[model samples]
Target: MSTFQRFRESWLRPILFFGNNLLSLIGGALTSASAFVLIGFYLVDAFGHGGSRNPYLGIILGFFLPALFLLGLLLIPLGILARHAALRRAGKIPSVYPRINLADPLFRHGIEVVLLATFVNFVLLGTATYRGVAYMDTKDFCGATCHVMAPEGTAYPVFAHSGVPCVGCHVGSGVGGYIHAKVNGTRQLIDVLRNRYPAPILTNDLLPSASQTCLNCHRADAWIGDKIRISTTFDDDEKNTRTRSLILLHVGGRDLTGKLSGIHGAHLGHIVYISTDTRHQIIHYVAKTEADGSVVEYTDTNLKQARVGVQRAMDCTDCHNRVAHSFDTPEKAVDRSMLAGAISPELPFIHKESIALLKASYGSPEQARTQIAASLKRFYQSNYPDLWQKDQPRIAEAASRLAVLWSQNVFPFMKVTWGTYPNNLGHNDYPGCSRCHDGSHNSASGQSISSDCSVCHNVLTIDDSNRSQLADLGVQ
Candidate 1:
């Protein structure tokens, strides 16, 4: 017999017989279709240029299609095995033993065909595995798949490190980090499926070590020098008088001599503290190690019990905890809008009105949007009738912008609103720098953590609208 004829009879006939069964047939069809679809998506994502990032592609290719493919692959073998058992019980074949002879043309042909099919199946499996893993690492898969992560999803894009992937910080480089993330992700997935996840999404368990994650991008020894920061605040008066505070931030880092100075240099890898609360808001004890290898421990004077709970080393995250996903306060949001020209600063009491609308409580996002716009429109029409008539479009535009700001920062479903996640970057907003350096923590030898403002930054000008300091430095 010809090689092709013998191969078809021995190999193709048996495969068709097993796979043609109802369950096996369905599984085979599904697996083939899903494999093709996933490959197509992978190709487009890999090669496409100048096209917008397609988040849904990651969902379909990384998660849904791979799951379907795996299910089908598993079903195929189970169906074939069941069919063999049923056939044996029915006495269609005397025994399940195969009549084999290596030298025979039929046997050789069957072996050849089996090897070929196996190779093809392995190739497809490899492709699917690669695509599945790659998809899971994407920002869309992490932030968009779970409704509980909506707050993070909304804030990430507007954050300073928006371009950086979620895994870059959450799951650092190396096999161990990847495995840890996957295991943790599985638990989170189970919680989501069972609806057992906590509201506001506590981040204590999700935090990765700063040395492994944050330090990967930010070098400790890199010179940061000083940063000039200008903050604008508006009064509630009719003129909405603008005032600017200019400060020279001493963000010094370690020099070649290994001398630690400034905010980051002073704290990074040197300070350890104990917090009684989960949020780390109430620090009870602090221990500082000097360059001479001497350790000085400080206890909070107010707290009767000093060593209350967990003692943790201070890291980058302690201060920059909300760096990637920070929500703005009502006042800050209004200030930003005016500065960006989204809301007219010329409008009388616009700052006060916008802040009031933002602070007001509402049941739903839709309600907030509608009410904010309505409230602003009513205020301008009733209080400043002439201004409202003259610049009706400006008022409406400002109201719409305010609504957008509210939606971006607040998520009613997740129980997140303005200031829900405290940004620990500054003292004025939250008990950030003051958590450890509030002057209340004193060592046994009488050394206290200095709460002096000059230690970290120098105030160039305080609430001066003239911006004299900026002008002198040739800055607008």
Candidate 2:
């Protein structure tokens, strides 16, 4: 007989003896079942024309099933060891395992079955593992699949960076990153199962650095000159008096002439700061690195002594923190709707009414929706009966729009209310640009960080009804 034949014949009897036990038999059955289920899921995902977009289904196929498959794999070896131990304890093990008769049809059939099963197990394991990891990296898995992420999930589709995947920001781009994400995900899963996760999840420290994620698409050296911004708002009066503001934003960056010019150019890689709070709104120190490698440090004069906080280099996310999941303030949300004609500005006190309803507290979104719509209708019915009857359709439209706006901005279940997350792009509603540019931070030689209005933006018009300048500039 050949060497392979001799080895197989010598080992086959013991393999059969050990694997015939109940534990090993059960392990084999479990392994076979899990493998088949995984194969079925893969086939459906591959051929079902977009498959099932259901998030829960993905959890099963992506995470739970794969875990089951791995457990089954582990049990196979454990069962073999248990069987070996049991036989030795019983003193049933012979001095040498019996040699098999290769010529016997039963032994030959058993060997053929084992070889085929092993080959199938290897193939399925590889395919299942690859698909499971790929599924976990999907946007749905990160957002819709997790209850704690509902607030972000609701806000993501409305923002500028909706096209990008969550992993683009949360996970790094290599084998190491993949491993880290999976390990973190496992811990998160455990927390979720135990109902121990924090509401309104904070991810400031959890995110990968901007260099690994954001810089992949937006280069810091790219040039972008000044840009104009026009904003409109309505007063709380009966007429809902409209006013507009025109501002020129100095969104400077590196220019084609190879000179760093604007806001992005000034801060992208040249600044470091200390934030004394989790939100990074309370900046206590600022340092600018000069072109000549000289560093000038500025300490916040308001702070009695230099307090320790998170010290880090400034990056895109420092300013554009809400680019992907931005929740608008009540005023901004109402203004956008009225501007879009979803909420009629023709209705008296509509802006004021909308703001009042948006700011009110409620136990849940459904309750908020019902209460807001009923409250608006009641206000019109009680105060302006004639107008209520005449413009009922407009009132209904406004109520529906406000209810949606409220739901979009507030998540009572997650404890995410108005301004739960601060946008650091500007200083209007939050301490954004003013955190470092308030002229309070002074260098040792008495140089202060400039708070001058003209440094960042120039306000051409403030709360004016006139659009003549915007018209003249062809931006109206």
Candidate 3:
């Protein structure tokens, strides 16, 4: 009976139903996936803004999403059509089925089938095109596609809000800004692909919108009081000399409107600070702006620019740059390893040995670590046998800690070794606090970061050139 009944329906009929329904299901899924992807992206954009001035990722995403939705919208109709065809073959003719004939003697039936599938094909093609364009526009894809960004990109995870996308901060508000960023981003991609990219490139560019972009959040009306910066160092000797330097805080805030300028203006709600390279490339600018139209810019350049206009812009990141994800500073790197008891501070030349091992260098980090250990062992065994035995354990720990510190701070790939990525928040590398504090810059105002540390901050003691002299003041 089964065989007799099956004889009435050709194998081709079932194949037709299966093919039709499968295509229909896939088409519907494609449409739904597009919606889901868009929603998911919107959610990610909303919560992922950190260190971002434009806070409008949602806006841009919303704007671009419509185009993608159109593509999905197109896909839905094709899916509907496929489902109608399948139902008709199942003997459940859809109310609006196109009378397609598979039993035709000529090629008419095949032509109709081709036409039907073509509609679905076109929709899928559109979806693919939209996805391709969208992916290219994403900051993650833009900043992360190349191997060159690996070292720097790795830094982004710990910077600002961990979830913030790269575009949030780099690309700000408006269609004008959007267009500029697109053009710039494409050019950067080309640079990476062609290897025409410059080394030590600045992440932030000129025409920074400290005036517009930053002032939205930080206002200039909330600044007051003197700032104090104090630092201490530990010597292996019984006496851990503490050096103190205190500065009266100088910060400005915005007017009724949230507008602030420079670090001097906004301690809290005032403005942002940014920094640039010597040529004025805003390498890693940091700071916020206030509603009253004030801004604080602290550039990596630290005002070492030999020129202007061509000078770089600074961002809040320049100093408070490492706010959340702090890597090891050279001294701090030593201190961490020493404190952890990882290295042998007891080893002869423990400090000196750590320095040398760090300096010796290797092609790879693993190589560096291995060589550092060997170098220390050889140095101690060859020179100070007694100290090596006593301090070997501490020294070993120090070596490991140094290796980790080097791993975090030293980027040998970009020709950045220890002390290579110099911190210019203040002026050690390029005039730092001195740039503003120098009597020359303040000649008009009669204010300066004088040679006398006491002017800006009460210096309790001096560590460099003269370590023994204490200010006699409580800090000294």
Tell me, by lDDT, which candidate is best. 2
User: What C-alpha lDDT does candidate 1 achieve relative to the native structure?
Assistant: 0.81
Point out the worst 10-residue segment of candidate 3 by lDDT: 50-59
User: If ranked by TM-score, best first, what sequence of candidates would result?
Assistant: 2, 1, 3
lDDT of 2 by residue, 1-476 (tens): 99887666566666776777776777787788888887787777789753559889887877677777777777777787888898899998877666776789997897898889889988888877787778777788888988888888999998788999999988887888778887988899899989998876787877777888998898877777889888888899998988888888888888877888667777854899998878888899989999999999999999866657777888888899998999999999999899999999999999999999999998887898899989999999999999999999999999989889888888887889999999999899899989999999999999998899988889998887457786787754
User: 321-374, model 3: which lDDT tens digit per residue?
Assistant: 443334445665665565555654455456655655666657877987887778
- Give the Cα RMSD of candidate 2: 2.0
By lDDT: ranked, best first: 2, 1, 3
Minimal lDDT window, size 10, model 1: 93-102
Stretches off by above 4 angstroms in model 2 are 49-51, 89-91, 98-107, 474-476
lDDT of 2 at 311: 78
lDDT of 1 by residue, 1-476 (tens): 89966766676556556554778867877777787776676666578741325666555666778888878788887887788688878867432234345679987886686577557666877877787788777777778866788889888998889988888889956898889899998898789889988788877546787888988988865778789998888888998898888889999888668776788788764788888878888899999888788899999998878487777888888888987878889888889889888999999999989988988888877898889889988998999999889999999899889888888888888888888888889988788888878998988988899988899899988888457667897655
- TM-scores, one per candidate: 0.86, 0.95, 0.56
Better of 1 and 3 by lDDT: 1
Relative to the true structure, how large is the alpha-carbon lDDT of every model? Answer: 0.81, 0.85, 0.52
Q: After superposition, how far is residue 349 of candidate 2 from its true place, in Å?
A: 0.5
